[model samples]
Target: MPSTDFLWWRDGVIYQIYPRSFADSNGDGLGDLPGITARLDYLADLGIDAIWLSPIFPSPDVDFGYDVADYLAIDPRFGSLEDFDRFVAEAHRRGIRVILDLVLNHTSDQHPWFQESRKSRDNPYADWYLWRDPRPGGGPPNNWASVFGGKGWEYEPQRGQYYFHMFYKEQPDLNWRHPTVREALLDVFRFWLERGVDGFRLDVFNVYFKHPDFPDNPPRLGLRAFDRQQHIYDIDQPEMFPLLREIRQILDAYPERYAVGETFLSTPQKAARYCAPGLLHATFDFTFLHSPWRPERFLRAIQDWEQALGDDSWPTYVLNNHDNPRAATRYGRGEDDARLKVAATLLLTLRGTPFMYYGEEIGMRDIRVSRSEIKDPIGKRYWPFYKGRDGCRSPMQWDDSPHAGFTLGHPWLPVHPNYRHRNVEAQRRDAHSLLNYYRSLLRLRKENSALRRGLFQPLTFEPRRLLAYLRQDEHQTILVALNFSSRPVRLAMGRTLSAFRWRPLISTRDEPLMPRDGFLTLRGDEAVILEREA
Candidate 1:
């Protein structure tokens, strides 16, 4: 049983499964709904409270599932509606809540609403999407660029007008100003809620609203011209808050259901605003995910969040996800797999809900995306500069089998070059594989209540090359210490140990750090969890 209150996600851990990359049951080289259905036990054994499945709704595959063609139906490439029902049922039976990804800011151009909206300027659906007259000289409506690296507006030959698509051209932005569109989307929400879903992870949650006047956004100031623009006209619009409240009202109508918004823009103070009581229950804290591998940077970012967000609202912390490169490639020193496992220990022991992206447990590295293998539109346009998200979105490495056991057919995306060295089958057999470390860390997290909801405070250690902290409650306290450097370090506790009994609960070293007296001497790349003496 979960130690924390059964709030669905109060300091709960969530495993994010990108369905197409998880596993494939059929020989079709693509992961489908039934494929994910087969993986429930894998997730359940990980001891997570919820599973955040990426978009599985019907889409044109323009941006994969992000470009939804129908708000209420499952994509045929995945499986039938009945398959999803079974997935939900099986997950619930295993004590895992299923949270679907809701992409509401836009829809595919192939959607019926968009089809009708583009038919004529006088049609009832004409205002359902953002439409604008072409520039006087017959060009795009503005100089704004799509996130996928092209003009944000696409001109329609039939209507002689342009429509806004903040992302890909196939994904046109929906006009929230339309009462009918909002109501229709709410109906879709009700459709799933009635189907027994626990909640939603709103994708691009902050990007749902736009400037009402269709004004041209001014250029950005500090970063690149793209980063310089305040996005005043494109995103973080003021209207999004009220809509969030309305959405929260809808969600609150259901029992034990929660909503988590993905806001990657800023720190916790900014992220916490999305979690303000009546809106989202939690928002993604992406600061740690973006920071360099430094103990000070990590400590400051986590402390900054606690100070900014207050103690009442829950926080979500993640190391990697479908959008980012694997942490092993980003933070690991070559051949130093222990560093990666130590990172996992920190992630699971942190004071917020931990989100483990699929394949992260196996220490998956970013798949090399060659120019020819590139499929993501963003990567195609950005090329060498960005390389898009395909590298990180490759199929999971289940084994050394062809296609890493993801499929018998050619996968939608190619597997990584490191598949043989790092896969589930090899790791499961190897006692020291990163996968086992993750399982042990997860089990440790579940066994200790203090690790779940205790106050977080950094231990002022010899901050030269080590990171240490303590998780404590009224009856129990655990000290977590990690050596971040490649050299041995001596850390003295300084009379802080006199009144308490102490025992070493966990150590990443092949041998104990040293005799437990007033200090602990740790070797390179080692982490230990210590319990207070009773």
Candidate 2:
């Protein structure tokens, strides 16, 4: 089923670069488009085919850049629209595609569309947003809670109505039912597509529409009101399909354009459905992000995804992103990158496209931001108990220099203290560093067909202690074996695997796999990839 022609997205590795934390060219303590353009060489050399940037549009920073006020303009804080054009041109020159994160779910209340819509109920733009009358005597329209805090309905005093916001109040969900809203948002796609953006990573696209009835979501057990509800009626609506088809039509009008979605609060089944044929090219499944450091956990995640995306769609996978803690911080034991190397091998060799988060290759850990230093709204709202996402959204570590060489001024978020030893500059010099291991695996992935578009066949011999699988695409079959524990383990697969000769391709360990001794042993926390030799 592989296409004879080149498909950059399907075959290439997409690196997620959080604009606010990637690099800061202006010494203003913030990362910007110019900073990203300057770093293109680094990304190209890192073996990534494309870069998926987080939103850089004009925003009040309520949800960072997710609260986009204007669709066409780039935020002055992140440089102007001119800077973005240059960045795209420079990225394309380096053979690296650019994908922008589109916040299709909502727009900042500061947006002219929302501002005019809230002017009065009779205004032409009044129906642009989901405005409703208070239930009885002025409670929210329903018990639906915002993903940030309180009720999803925010009262608008001037309009004598409540508008729905799935996230913060500053961010209001657009009424997809309104034909104008649909056309306006679809035009956002065309705007960027015309600007030569290769594709889009739709932010919370699944939650774009809610049930027309506006019913109270059922209660569930959780600390925050947002998570306390089952989120049934508020998400995964039927109307999304037609809208997706329309979005697909817009993208298909352009050559080689791609679109992937971030399915907010989605399951493997729900996420996979959005990737069906013409709807979306793929959807981000965060199963790997939440997975524990165990073979059984990853095995289950892989099988569930493989089964979910079977035949109908291609899949997308991620280990970490701006909103979550880094994999190294979550799985690595006391700065040890052994666990990370093992995880990277699994991610890169898998059949689907893998998104490597910024600073992940150097194994950057989450920096703890105390209550006083917390900047993220999500973190600020859930402080003490949850601490907030500022820990994960810290600036990218570049060198041992002050502020990790991210900026001359103070970073908006604190840089991890480990930058002295863990920054990119330090790791790049170490031939056996985690950064180099990623480089090697990425190179191996490109060099091997089975590792790219292959069908996954899980090896369940040592299901709990060792994770193993075969990736076969017609020509070559690659066996990826990883020892999940801290102790060495020997492969015990039956005659099916024993029939072939495994020629070593890559390994996380210092020495390559020596399999001629009639037994294959995986050193502690090691991952090895082997190809069948004819």
Candidate 3:
């Protein structure tokens, strides 16, 4: 509702909720639909326009909901279909849209389709998954490797065939080339659309289709076996684009609907095409998530995205997700919210739509998981060296209580040890907490049109550590200056924006920060949003 003049996806913020870790109401220590429904008012107060829930479909929990077993049903661990309907209705009532994560690329090995497909080649679902025969001698069809650190091909002795998987062996890649397979997956979208899911975040959508020939991926210099190959044949195939168009057609039939994608190994150039007109509405740019904690790096990622967008496409940015470590830990000093406040300012004031991971508002840090405590298969396979994603997928910290107020029962993953002090309840009471900082930034963007749908204009001013930019429209012009360093910097207003009168809208510093003697002095690790007047 901030910018009623533009598309909601283009002008609004989306909050990512990993349902398993968000909240648990059933005392089962796993988050559920009803748990989310109970927290609608909090999300509404946080000022997000939509909530992109990670996969909640029925699953064997092999991949923690990503290996979907049933596209039309809810996982019993999460709740029932009726509970999901109530959650969506509650979100809609609070002016928050619901975007379900659709994993069209693969399914759990236990899925009925795979069960039948693996029994024999003549079954109705025999071709539902990508099943191939062994090589001439006694090896996999090609040299494709799984993303979770093993050979991508799993030999099924029952069917005497090997199925390809881009991720874990539990997740068998679907045969999107099969007309029936495509139709069945597309129908999954329609089912959820009819159920009032406002949009979908297509999981690993770029890998939906692989090369028909199943050729061996060319080798490259890299860290591990999976990264050693160029992955030219396994991902970003031409066939996926047409499927996106078909999905777009289905979404277009409904009003105010949306669809964004999560491209495996996402790139700006690919996003340019994936978000092209008549295709996806947008695709998550992980550049912001993986970029170094530097001012120039962030500026470069923002500028690159601007150049990559076509005439009809928009840019979406992400800094944290379930699979990545929390940005608060990546970019901030231990127990310091200064850098987080600065990052929040830039994330909220940028040209594109910003995505907030759950618990990011209170500056949640990653929960370190030891090898014995790891739940993620990725962590188990690559422990001590990589340590996997379980650190970031921990339960949300709500209060300083047993299990961080997530549940009375044990949590699926450990809550961050710092949750006792850094949590929503404690931060809610502190005026200067990171939670309040996010609320202020969201409120500022909502009240200012120049900050919401205006064009982004990067300022030439900088000491290399400070990245300043302007957001301008016919109505007003706003300046956002961020100091990435721990030392203050002074920027002179000698030309350009200096011609207009300015007012300070918000800043990370406790004291009022404004220009003095035609110069703006920024505190260490500080960011300020100022509105300029003619």
lDDT of each residue in 171-234, candidate 2, tens digit only: 9999999998888888899999999999999999999899999988899899888888998898
lDDT of 3 by residue, 1-534 (tens): 245575667788999999999989989999888888888889899889999999998888888899989999999888999999999888888888999999989999888889889999998999999999999887899999988887999999998999998888989999999999888989998999999999999888899889999999999998878999998999999998888899999999999899999878878887678989889998977887788988888888888888989457788878899988889879889899999999999899987788999999999999888789998887787777888888888899999999999998999888888989998999999999999999999989888888887898887433388888889887888888888899988767667556778888898887646777777889899898888865
| Candidate 2 Cα deviation (angstroms), residue 216 | 2.4
Ranking by TM-score: 3, 2, 1
Judge candidate 1 at residue 426 and give its lDDT. 91
Candidate 2 collision pairs: 379-388
- Greater lDDT among 1 and 3 belongs to 3
> What's model 2's TM-score?
0.97
RMSD of each: 2.0, 1.7, 1.4
TM-score of each: 0.95, 0.97, 0.98
Error of model 2, residue 27, in angstroms: 0.9
| Model 1, C-alpha of 74: deviation from truth (Å) | 0.9
Candidate 2 displacement at residue 253 in angstroms: 1.0
> How would you order the candidates by lDDT, starting with the best?
2, 3, 1
Better of 1 and 2 by lDDT: 2
Candidate 2: list runs displaced more than 4 Å.
Answer: 1-4, 516-518
